[model samples]
Target chain A: MASNLRSPLARVRGLGSAKDGTGHWWAQRLTALALIPLTLWFVAGVLGHVGADYAEVRAWIGHPVTAGLFLLLIGATFYHAALGVQVVIEDYVHNEWAKLASLLTVKAALLILGLAAALAVLSILFD
Target chain B: MSAQDEAASDPKARRPLSPHLQVYRPQLTSALSIFHRITGIALAVGTLLLVWWLVAAAAGPEAYAAASGFIGSWLGLFLLLGWSAALFYHLANGIRHLVWDAGYGFELPTVYASGWAVVIVTGALTLLAWIVGLVAW
Candidate 1:
């Protein structure tokens, strides 16, 4: 029982503490901080564009500021989501092999989707 | 005792599992904490819809129309409503967490107050968004 106590540093790093203590925790919080403004802007923008046609939506995304903010939103969102789901998996998935596999799979999938989303935004902006 | 000593003395002794959920009475703090994680997962799954909408919009009018058509359906609207609720709840609760991280709001009264605030604020925000969405549409 005494041996089970994690150091403060380990707790700060969250589940996996591979040298850089608090890195994962800080990343999660920082991304969450970033998302606050980005998500609000996105929600408001989407609401503003409700029922809009293709051209209207396309033009919105094509605007330089909109495109830049959206790209930032995409990157931050997917990265934060991956970090979050990773912790959830680590907590509930008891089997070691299954846990590792799921973590890797989530990371890969989010990476691909993030890139795809960025590409979609870029194509719209450029087109 | 040291690991080796314990192992030698009680070879069959193994690590015990932590207490399970059923063992404890549910409380607001615990419930809200669990909900935060649940909504986090929900939002992750909901991201697919966002990605699809973006890709469809980028693809062409035809693709955009298809995506919009589906999203306009009853089931799609229902899911979006739920997703919006989850998003707002997660957002509100996340701010609460940030507040906690700042080393305030740890008092029991404050914790419960913030928990209820999160719930109420989320409901209000979701309703507002949906109303605005419908009006805009």
Candidate 2:
């Protein structure tokens, strides 16, 4: 069974499939599923703390359970966002070079932002 | 477009996409699908608000004040409302997609019903969230 049915011309030029099968699709769905509950929890938590003092909200996030959820939520949120925005870029940005540059910029920015947020959570938890 | 690829078929004027906008009529099904992506991307951008609030809180009381000040401002509240609406739309539509992946709801009536259901649920949840957030304190 020839799994790679791509034309030799296409193969020679090497502008074909992304080759990773359903990894992107699966990861997107998994992250979406994880977000279902995480997002609800977050919305409720934020609403609960509305109009509360800084110390009150800080203590809430500093709690072990809340911090743990924040970590998970941060990781999943950024990963999911990067993957998604990448798809949108690929879809509308027809120019090859521009698409590549945008995707790179977006992924890098999200990575940095995600890490910063995670670190903030950890700092809050341990401080 | 590569020379070889463009020669075979002009990428800009790509052919045989049967349901393209030129011939396709917009319907609930297509509109809902569009909103799914729209809301999804909006939420992706909206994550910035979350990150900023978290980092500011971790910084100190003064920083938290800055963050909360912005979030409490009219513009921030407006954006928050949009973000929450987008979140709910994406969440509800996402669940519909999950059910679709599970191999049901492909029937036309079912699909239309689910699409409407997603919209209704999004509206209800967003309203609930805003009331609970803005007034329940």
Candidate 3:
């Protein structure tokens, strides 16, 4: 009962092609591209607000444009960081279960923290 | 056990392992590539500080003061300085990666040159940021 399905080359390659190739790679690069300008803007904005009081800092965050951009920065920075860290874990973590646990932890932390940061910005903007 | 199973379970089996860092002479290009990953992880962990500051600011003046106090302290300043440098290095090297993705800068000389540029740019940006921060404070 020989079923001729996959070609010899495909059979030889085995499960290597099962993974979502290039998606992670492309996502990492795309997020990096988005961060370039966002990071520069963030650095400049922080520098401009140096030595300011809490009220002044809150006021700065409360601005419509600044809050919007800050939200964008939070999202991109966390997402990019998660993707980058996932690769490091996958490469270095030898134990399969540990690797899975770590990957899950990193992603969960990023999601929770990203949401919290965004909410903080929103609260300031509305207050 | 079957021969196939025995072969699969054999400890002495020869399989391809990734080239270890010890095998290669450390070059600027290789060092920068490794540093890129290290800084990326640092930046990831450093995002917690950013989140804490934002939450504190949103919470109230007292919370904000507490957070700012820690950030203004010597140890906090040191960590922040390191974080800022990591951020800049990761950002610069990330741009170099984007260029590589665009199908350029693969030439050996160009790669090495870009690696050094990332290092120099990271240093300059970090120094400039600290200078501005200190002067403004």
Candidate 4:
């Protein structure tokens, strides 16, 4: 190797000089992994609604098991999107101020949308 | 006047550090960055479609029928196909990232090879999903 005399720690132990962040990378993947089965279930549930009437749709959501699954899907998906979008802004937005601003904006938007959707689903199933 | 001469300028200020993308030929790392960005945008827009589907389903039969009708259109089908591909690609790539985090694919050749693998696997899965979807219809 080019630096055979150096220890392996020298090559990797303190490489954070760039102030680089890894949480965003890790979180995105984690959430995606979580969403896999949830997403599949969601697609199937929607497919089940193909020709169902309004009451049928309502009744489906009203089922405790379905409502619980739907909520899990919503929460996981929005959280996943928020994490993914944060990384996108970090990679593309070169301007520091603009990057931070855009990141916050995406986070807030996802949070609001995710909560709103969850509430809507809950209200339907509950009342 | 009391300060010493500032003749000793910063030694590292002008020295070259690590090579950047500008210096190297395109590689998988660069390609991964681009792929991540594209997938991120796709996910964002795809979320809107999800929200719309939910709203329509929640609204009532007429609204759900209208939305589903639009979804049945050729344009809707095309978009759905694209979105499904995006979802699968992102999912496969996410697994790649996790593997990478644990430091398995760090070798130069392995990096590129796995990148190609990700692409191939994502396409295969997308096609599989569509095939399954067709059977359902």
Which candidate tops DockQ? 3
Per model, state how many residue pairs clash. Answer: 0, 0, 0, 0
Residues B52-87, model 1: lDDT tens digits: 898998899898898889999999999999999999
The positional error of residue B6 in candidate 3, measured at the CA in angstroms, is: 10
Best by TM-score: 2
Query: Model 4, residue B83: displacement in angstroms?
Result: 0.6
For candidate 2, the TM-score is 0.89
Candidate 4 yields a Cα-based lDDT of 0.75
Off by over 4 Å in 2: A1-16, B1-18
| Whole-model Cα lDDT of every candidate shown, in order | 0.91, 0.89, 0.90, 0.75
In model 4, residue pairs whose N, Cα or C atoms come closer than 3 Å (at least 3 residues apart or on different chains), thus clashing, are none
**DockQ, every prediction:** 0.78, 0.70, 0.85, 0.37
Query: Would you list the clashing residue pairs of candidate 3?
Result: none
| Candidate 2 residue pairs that clash | none
Between candidates 2 and 3, the TM-score winner = 2
**Where does the lowest 10-residue lDDT sum fall in candidate 1 chain A?**
A11-20
Positional deviation of residue B99's Cα in model 4 after best superposition, in angstroms: 1.3
| TM-score of each candidate's B chain against the true B chain | 0.87, 0.88, 0.88, 0.78
lDDT of 3 by residue, A61-117 (tens): 999999999999999999998998999998888678899999999999999999999
List ranges where model 4 is wrong by over 4 Å. Answer: A1-26, A44-57, B1-24, B27-29
